[model samples]
Structures are given as C-alpha cells and as structure tokens.
Target chain A: MPTAPAGTLYRGREGMWSWVAHRVTGVSIFFFLLVHVLDTSLVRVSPEAYNAVIGTYQTPIMGLGEAGLVAAIVFHAFNGLRIALVDFWSEGARYQRVMLWVVLGLLVVTMAGFLPRHLMNVFGAE
Target chain B: MTAVLENSTDTSGSESQAGAVSSFQVTLKIRRYNPEVASEPYWEEHTVTAHGTDRVLDALHKIKWELDGSLTFRRSCAHGVCGSDAMRINGRNRLACKTLLKDINPDKPITVEAIKGLPVLKDLVVDMEPFFASYREIMPFLITSGNEPSRENIQSQADRDRFDDTTKCILCAACTSSCPVFWTDGQYFGPAAIVNAHRFIFDSRDQGGTQRLEVLNDKEGVWRCRTTFNCTEACPRGIEVTKAIQEVKRAMITRAF
Candidate 1:
C-alpha cells in the first residue's frame, strides 16, 4: 500500500543490462520452444496434417519472426557462456565488460551468416 | 555564543571564504514525502549558492538550515565512514557525504532521493530493518571451534589477503539497494550480506564456512543473484561485492560435489 514513485531508473552499466537482456531473451526462447513442440508433435496424426502445419510457418512474416527468434537465441547462448566464465574464472568479473563486447561481436557474426540465406529461402519466388 | 553560531554556517560564510573562489548557486530537486502533510510524494527543488569543495551533504544541510526547515535526512561523520548518508543521486546509489556537488554536474539540478528497494520513512531516511535483517542472517563474525587459543588466534598474511577486499564494508546499504533484483523482490539476501559472509567465510581463523555456505545455498540466497554488477558499482567502499557474492556461490557449488 506504501507504493510511491521512487526515483530515476538505476543507471547500471554493462553487467546489469546484460542480465536483463538475458532474462528477456530466455523467456522469449522458452515460449518459442513451447510452440515448436506443439507443432512438431502433429507428426503422429497424419502426413498431410504435419505438412499443413509446417506450410503455415513458410510465410514472410513467420520468416521475420524466425529471424527474431534466432537473434534472441544467439544472444542468449553467447551471454550464457559469459555468465559461466564470470562464475568459474577468477578474473572473469574484472573482464566481464570486455566479454560482453565479445558476446555481441559473436552475435553479429552468427546473425549475418544465417539471415541472408534464410531470407532467400523464405521470400524467393520458388 | 551568537558569534560562534554566526561563523558556523556561511550563507555567506565558510564557503565563500574557503578560498579566493566565490560560491556558485546549484539546484537540488529532492523527493519529499511526509504522511502527516501529503499522502503522496512530491519533487521539491531549492537552489543555493555552494562552494567548489561543498559535497551533497553540505548542500542538504544548507537547504535544511537556510531554505527549508522542514527538509529531513540522516547523516553522521560527514566524511563517509558512517554509511548513514547513502542515497540515490542522479540515478545512482552513492554516499552524499562523498559525492561532491561539482563532480555530479551541478549545472543541471541534481536529483536526490532515498536509496531504492526499501520503504521510505521520511524525506531521505528509509526503513533499514530489512537490509539489516539480511546482514544479521549472515552471522558476520569470526566463528571458531573449541580449544581456544591462550592469547589470540593468529592468521597468516596470505590468509588475511583472501578476504582483504571484502573487509572494507561499512554496511552502507548502497550496494544492496541499487540491486535490480532486490528492488523487484525484497526476499533476496542481497550482495551486502553475501559480501560480509565472504569476509568471515574466507577468514583462515573462522570455522563456520560450512554453516555459512548452507545459509547462502537457500532458494532466495546466492542462487538468486544474476551476476548483475550493480552491487559492485554502487559500493562506496570499493568492495568487490559481485565478486564476493560469486565467491560465496562458488563455495556452495564446491561444497556440493
């Protein structure tokens, strides 16, 4: 009941923001996984049923959604490794900011390699 | 007595004459809440002339004495050792006594408020009970076994160095309150408690490592920390708070297997 507007947002540096991003990307990935499981489980019913479900996902909008999902997955995977290093390595905390740059660099590289090819497969008039 | 009092505070006093440089005016926008007066909190601004050497604490003192007698805050040992003056200044947790008005860009009105993650008791004071409760739960002491030493329990220099970084804690709630998780949910034990636990856990002379690790291994304990370094950045004492909490977490993981 004593809730009151506190103050300005806490201006945390890289480490804090990374944790927030990790949480968000993690939850989004979980939801994506749930959808994937439900759709893939349709294979048991009939071949046409599973093919129809897969066909619905071949559109350009779903292609964009898949791209976003890949971006989230890429960031979460790389940042997860960074968190592990921050825990296991003695100098990890000192170098966490540097590692964040590395993780971001890796995300950019991974996304660049996957985006154009995936976009062509979805949007090309085949 | 009146003359001594007159020389004590310089609306035109200690500041203007501290050196050849005259005082300059700076504005402070403070968050104020008094249940008796207003049911809601409001932003109050007061601009006062301050010297280059003046800290945020001194500015607050000037506001309370000269501008508004109703302004209230807590402070002692104005140099920063006491830790009672921790507050959020310009969107960060810092000791008001240590943060200089000049350092925080006084050209823009500095926003001052109670440190977050705790119930605000008044203008800048907060309910420190929860913060202290977590600290107390850690058992911050040199716990040892029987067959006590006749004179003292001696520890090697190498052993002392193990926890040297954590030993600088002044119990300022700056680190704990700045934590995002603690702000979301007050149930987390917080970084200050884990840092203090690291102080005693790594002490070569202490025999309570196992018990302390068990405490930190709780559901709402070290496991809840998400490696956010806000606690490390907010510590006024330069304590490696996040590192210490990770060390406590590592100690728990090591004890398990």
Candidate 2:
C-alpha cells in the first residue's frame, strides 16, 4: 500500500478534492438514472402497477430520498461546471477554492429549499 | 597533440592540477555502431576532459573533437530551446546541455545514449521523423471556418484567458516521450498533441472546435490516457497535461448532450 503521492500540492489547492467529489457524484447520478429508467418502465407491467410505484415516490419518506437525489445532482452539476471552466479557461486554477465554496453553497441552498417541503409533507398541516 | 601534452602535464602535480581546472577526466560509455565495421551496436569507452560547468553536450563534443571524429550526434542552438539535443542521459530522456554534471553525478561517469522508442540514426541522434509525423497528423494549428479577421477580431479578455495556459507548449516532445501510451501505440495522440488540440478547442476566436473534437474523438485520441500523470510530471513547461486531457473527455461527454 504505497500511500505516498508522487508530487507536492500546489499551495494547498482543493482541485484534487473537487475531482474526487465529481467522480462520486457522477457515479451516484448514473445509478439513479438507471433506477429511474427501470421505475419508469413499470408501465410495461400495467398502469396500476406503474401508478403504485409512482405513488410511492410522492410520499414524505420518499421526499427525503428525493431531496438527497436533488442534492447529489446539484453538487455534481455545479462542480462539473467548475471542472469544465478550469479545463477550458486559463485562470481556472486561481479560482479553484472559490469554485469549491460556490459548489458547497449551492448544495446547501438546494438542500435547504428541498428540506422544508420534505418536512411539510412528513409532518402535515404546516 | 593536445591529448599528449595534457597527459604529460599531469606528471607536474599541483601546477597541472591548478591549470587543469578547465578540463577534468570523464569516462563516457557511448553506444556505437558502424555499417562498415560492427555487426551490432557496441559500447565504446572514451576518456575525455570536460569542465565542471560543462554539460553532457560538452562531453560529447570532447569525444567528437579529440578522440574520434567519426562519432555522430545531434545538437543545435547549443541551448535548451531547440529541443534538438534530446537524448537519454544516465537512463533518462533530457536535453544534453540542460543536464549539468553537478545535477547528474560529479564523481561517477555519465552514460550517454540515444532517445528511446525511436530508430537510431547513428550514435546519439535518433530519427525524429516519426515523432514529427504524429505531431502533424494531429493538426497542431488552429483551423477556423469563420471569415478572416477584418481588423483585430473581437474576443472577450475572459474567453482569451480560458485557453492561455494550454498555449505555452514548445512542442519539445518531452511530454510525448514521457508517456506510456505513446510508447505502446504510435497512433495514440499523446499528451503534447492533445494539449495543443485543447488550446484551440477552447479558444474563443477559433470556430473549429467541432472539427478538432471529431479528430480527437477517435479510438486513439484522448481516451487512451490512463491518467497516470507521467506526461504532466515530465512536462518541462509546467502545463497541466492530465487536466487538459480530462477537459477533452468532458467535452466529448457534454457535446453528446
């Protein structure tokens, strides 16, 4: 287990961390897409069966899961855009930390908006 | 005559040592070949006097000037910019003049050899025609469909800043030589060429992004990079070579959308 990185970091940069997060989010979104495709394909079984599966997704508990999915998608999209910017642009490295904070901020804000709706559905009458 | 005089001067002790500061003994185990003489290449040792400040280029010059005039090697500019002096010194590819004695080894002898993964032309010079052919096949220049600039074409400073880092490549083939895929598959667009492609693909003034991406989307294109980061490590100009390749990959995926 050679844990040693081959090169020194460039002034405590977060580019590597952002890169790892992008990969994780990419894989998560891919699996979610797969399950989404299968779930939508439930119409082949019957309209009733498909509605039941669709109905399960609208519940308060499922809303929390949906919120997590939204969080993953938001984080992935924002960070992916940052990576694309860094790749295409020259001064991309200079704003790498700023991009990280921006992505995190966007994730927090998206989760905040989703959680209120999710809790209202779960607790009722609020 | 100079060698004979210097040999006898060594007998005078301290005076010779002081005067000999301009030259010091070094053993060069150079790889040699002759169509008229040997069946295969063989090692030939030549003891040459080189200054301490002298690089491997100086040692080869000693061999060519004093010892054997028949020895062949390639050198131009006598500086690092030309990239013509690339050779394997002590089992690593680098420019001869760029490698100083203090950097390699001051005491032990230095081994000088031809650049690897290329056909040998003579002694130290390898054929770079194949290397250049790959570079040309990648279309290293900007190709645009838009009308020529009437005056100075307008592009935002921010857009110009996007591709500025990728434009610093000197086409030295240092990154290509340091790549493992280029060593295995000659058809693969190695890091240097792909970096150059990226330079134009992201350029705001360039309208040939689709055409260049079509060329790079081939099987032997940017996908061949295993993300080993060796090319990035070997880049002399400090280009983020892996990051450029990853950008091309991202473009391939996003363009699908």
Pairs of colliding residues, candidate 1: B10-B13
- For each candidate in turn, the interface RMSD (Å) is 1.6, 12.2
Q: What is the lDDT of residue B117 in candidate 2?
A: 51
TM-score versus the correct structure, for each prediction: 0.91, 0.59
By lDDT, the best candidate is 1
Candidate 1 segments exceeding 4 Å error: A1-5, B1-19
> A95 in model 2: Cα distance from truth in Å?
16
- Distance (Å) between predicted and true CA of B129, model 1? 0.9
Query: Which one wins on DockQ?
Result: 1
Q: What TM value does model 2 have?
A: 0.59
Candidate 2 chain A: worst 10 consecutive residues by lDDT? A1-10
